[model samples]
Target: MDAVRNPYTPGTGRKPSALVGRDEVLETWRVALERAERGKTDQPLVLYGLRGVGKTVLLTQLRHDAEKRDWWVVQVEAGADVGLRDLLGEGLYEPLSEIARQGLGRRALRALKTALSFKASYDAGGTWTFGVDLSGASGGGADSGVLRTDLKRIVKDVSLGAREEGVGLAILVDEAQDLSSDELTTLSMVAQAAAQDDWPVLFAVAGLPSLPQTLSEAKSYTERFHYSHIERLSHTDARAAFARPAQEEGAGWSDQALDYVVAESGRYPYFIQQFGQSSWDAAEGPVIEIADARVGVARGQNHLDSGFFRARWDRTTASEKRYLRAMCPGGDTGIGTGEVASRLGKNLNALGPTRAGLIHKGLAYAPDHGIIAFTVPGMESFIGRQPE
Candidate 1:
């Protein structure tokens, strides 16, 4: 078998040949999109999980599925530096343009543009003003300011326009935990306004475990999101994930070999693909042997180390690295706050900012009330072999 025909994709946001154990989530989204198009209301979605769990991949797949159903979509990955307004503006450009041409009035169209390219200014009372011209007299409310009011207006226009075009509007956001408080509030307002008008607007956001809390803290109403947990695959699905691609390529996998790959990869989708590719490359004939899988496992470990964990490790500062090194003993799951603080010889309160920083950087997360863990799987192992 030629290597060029490998059916596995293990890179960033790449959809693998067999997207195993994800049919339930995908089907849920399919129904939501169909219902939205039919003017039915549903709570927006919030997808949360650890790193390398296929959230980004699922977001892309959902967007593709929506496009197939004649829905209009705007998608973007949120970041620390990327403000929500600008992020939305960048992703929404083509969709908004299409909607504007579909028949938005001059005023609504202008409002959308100003909100897209906002310039901040502070009034005498130190309140920031965005110059958003809402048609009504505004004293002061959550929906008053520029980003809030105008973002709502933008959604109203886009969703209504999409309805006129006989399609639904889906806002797919990845790395959504990085969104600022203001940005999150505005996004919630947009969804609320669309719901009120019976406009078909759907929001699907993917991020770490804390995403729902972040969104809700930004706006209490945001707690209503329908959360979908995308974690590792089951043993049965894991074996099929590796076997399906090899089978499709006219290659047969031994049960022992498949078992080795599944056990070594421990149900992580990316690792499963890497192991499959390595085993396929190492195979001498049509059948993948246990020896071939061992070689693939070794190679897969190196690949995950040098590529996945190393890249994230290289991005942190010295203090952040130390903070992570302490959490490594916790392994894939995570370490308790008091334990990590004791390991760092600091108070738990003192390490709050540093801990929060790691979460903000997407390097780690606090899965429980007082426990911290790296976002990537087996991150502790990567940290254990480090110099400091």
Candidate 2:
């Protein structure tokens, strides 16, 4: 089999040849888009999961769904170094530019002007006009220095402008757990305003398992927002995820091979694609067998060890690595911070900086008040394999 035909894409946010096990979430997003066009609003959607579980892929798909409906969509990845105001202002430029043409409706012009004000709020030097005349437009208060006030004004104007064109607006944020508390609070407030006033706008954010908790702490109203917990594929869906792509390319997987790969991959979408690709390459032809799967798993594990796992491992400082080692015998499950500090022969308060550093680096997260766990599945095994 030619490697070129391999349909398994194991990169970040890569859409699989067959996106299995997420039909419900996709359908819900689809319905939300349709309803928005009819002037109905739905709660913001929050997706939470461990790394490689396909939250980013699903968030990207939701963006695609809105795009297909001609909705004004802004998708961005939140980061600790970047503020939400700048990320959003930059994300909106392309969409606003796409519709900034002559003879634009008043609502569109107003939205464009408000967008200019939003941009000015963040970057006083850089500017964008979208090549439209807005001398008489009625939207410019977005320049206010307040995040909540400015964001609300721009979102309202832009969503209303989208409604004038018979569609809705969508804001999708990835890695949302990295956003600051203030940023998160402002977003929640704006989203609540949008929902209460029936603005044609929808927000979908994806992040680690702690995201729901983070949002709840940011604003209690987030309790009412739709939260979807994305996890590893079920056995049946895992089978389909592994088998469908190869089948489409005239390649089939023997039952033993499929079962071996599915189980060995732990049903995680990223691991499935990696093993599927490796297994396909190991196979001689039309059908992949158990032996091929064994070879594939071996090769896939090597790839993950060197690339996926090693990358995160390398990012940790020597001290951070030691801290990670202490958490390992616990392996993937949340471990009490007290125990980790005890294992290191230090007071719990002494390791506070180390624990916070790991969380900030995205390698670990606080699953509960005093519990810490790896954000990436199988990370414990990877750390165990490392030399002292």
Candidate 3:
């Protein structure tokens, strides 16, 4: 039979088995769940990393595992344009309403029904809008802080009510770095209050490398949140990632093909998936050989060149694109900021805007010891294909 089509995706979500090299993340999630179950009211947890490092996949897996254990999970992504009330109204209130409608007692259900109906007056154009006036039954007050506090209380009350039904609450937020300073502070306050009350509320957040510090700056109590920085896979795990999928499909890979896949992927899970999928497609028969590996690498490179990398590359200005081409060859060993600046013949300060843009786009990352490099393996190849 032909090898299985690559179910793994770069920008989209996939399963743990479909994803390669995330054992550490899985274990961290398991420990967090255990702690929550034991009633340890420790602070919430944050999973921070560069984009394409499998943070999203890890969180998705955690949500699935939490559900299997009967935990009530809510997921939200804080976008650049999303605001505080919008998030609270949509992300928090909607879920609480659903949970209440399904299982809460008549009194609790009535409370929710009252709140939902009071808020319904603001619903126009099919979007729920909250007014600045603070006299409403939903607790809108002139003071922004008071309004935020009331919203937090509402969410906490709903969460506590759910826990009484034997379901722990977990709120998973992605792109957390995009949250406004006020919103971050509000969330931190809510989390701290939940912990103090011994409520079964856990937060799992994923964002850019700067997220932890941002959270800390938002609230001093946020220092208690556990931090997990997702990294690329080890060589051993990288090899297994390539082999497992082939074995699962009743197809096999030759020794040379395996080595080439690992070397080319540089142990990045997304890159490994891309390479494995392309290689399996290039295989002549059930067994993938050395020649198949070569064709697969070429095909994978072409796919990225035209699709993944090109989409990001085409969005930059001319000078920014030039800077990217200068930094493409370092591979696993990335270039220092000074070295990159020198190659571009521009002062480090002058290139700051370009560097920031690249980082924001997830095309580059800061490795340990402050070295900046490509976010994905084989990205250097993609950068080279850009017009100089």
Candidate 4:
């Protein structure tokens, strides 16, 4: 098999060749889009899961679906270095520019003016001119310096503009768990306003497993938002994820080989892709054999250890690494903070900073009160392989 023909894509947020086990979500989003166009607004869609489980990939697909329908879609990734206002304001420029023209709809002109205010809210020295005069348009209080007020203004006006085009607006955020409490609360409130007013706007956010809890803590009403917990594929779907791509390339996988890769990959899409790519390269040709699968799994594990897992591992500080080592005894499952502290010969309170540091670094999260677990699958095994 030619390496160039390998269809598996095993990188962060990379869309796999055959996206499987997510039809239910796709269909739900499709219906939501249609409903919005019909003036039936739905709650925001929330996707929470572990790393490498394809949440980002699925979020990207949702963006694509809205893009195909010509929705005013703006996708951003929340990070410590960027505020939600800056992210959304910057992401909106190109879409706003694309629809800007002379004699544009009043609602669009309004949105353009509101967008200018929003931009000024963050960057006072920079501005965007959609090549149109907005001297007569009415809409520009988005620079209020209040997140909720400003966000609602932009979303309301832009969604109205989209409605005039018989479409809707979409805002997709990745790593949503990183957003500050104020940012998250503003988003939830704006989304509620959009739904109540039937503003024809939809929002989708993707993040680690703690995201739902984070959202709920920010605003209790976020409980009403549509939630989907993405996880490993089913055994059947896992098999298809591997087989379908190979078949498309005029290659086939023996049943034994398929089982070997799927089980070894634990039905996780990223590992499946990494191992599948390795298997394709290791095989002699038209059909993948069990022996080739063994070699491929070995090679894939090496790649993961060196790149995927190692990169995250290297981000930890010396204290964080020790804390992570203490966590390995529980494997990938959550361990109580007390237990981890006990293992490290420290008081639970003394380990608070270390525990919080790992969570801050996105290497671990509190799945429940006082219970911490790796955000990445197979992280414990990776730690065990690491020399103390």
RMSD of each: 5.4, 1.0, 4.7, 1.0
- The number of clashing residue pairs in each candidate reads 0, 0, 2, 0
Give per-residue lDDT, candidate 3, residue 218.
85
- Candidate 1 lDDT over 84-137, as tens digits, reads 766775677665555545454454444344434332211223332334443442
| TM-score, cand. 2 | 0.98
Weakest lDDT window of 10 consecutive positions for candidate 4: 99-108
Query: Which has the better lDDT: candidate 1, or candidate 2?
Result: 2
Q: Of the candidates numbered 1 and 2, which has the greater TM-score value?
A: 2
Query: Candidate 2 clashing pairs?
Result: none
Candidate 4 vs. true structure, TM-score: 0.98
Most lDDT-accurate candidate: 4
lDDT of 3 by residue, 230-345 (tens): 77788888888788877876777888888988898777776777777788788775888888888888898788677767777787788877877778567335788887888878
* Candidate 3 vs 4: which has more TM-score: 4
Query: Could you give me the TM-score of model 3 versus the true structure?
Result: 0.81
| Model 2 residue 193 CA deviation in Å | 0.5
lDDT of 2 by residue, 120-210 (tens): 9999999896876788888988988999999999999999999999998999999999998888888888988998899999999999998
* Candidate 4 lDDT over residue span 273-365, tens digit each: 999999999999799999999999999999999999999999889999999999977848898888888888999998888888888888899
Winner of 2 and 4 under lDDT = 4
What's each prediction's TM-score?
Answer: 0.87, 0.98, 0.81, 0.98
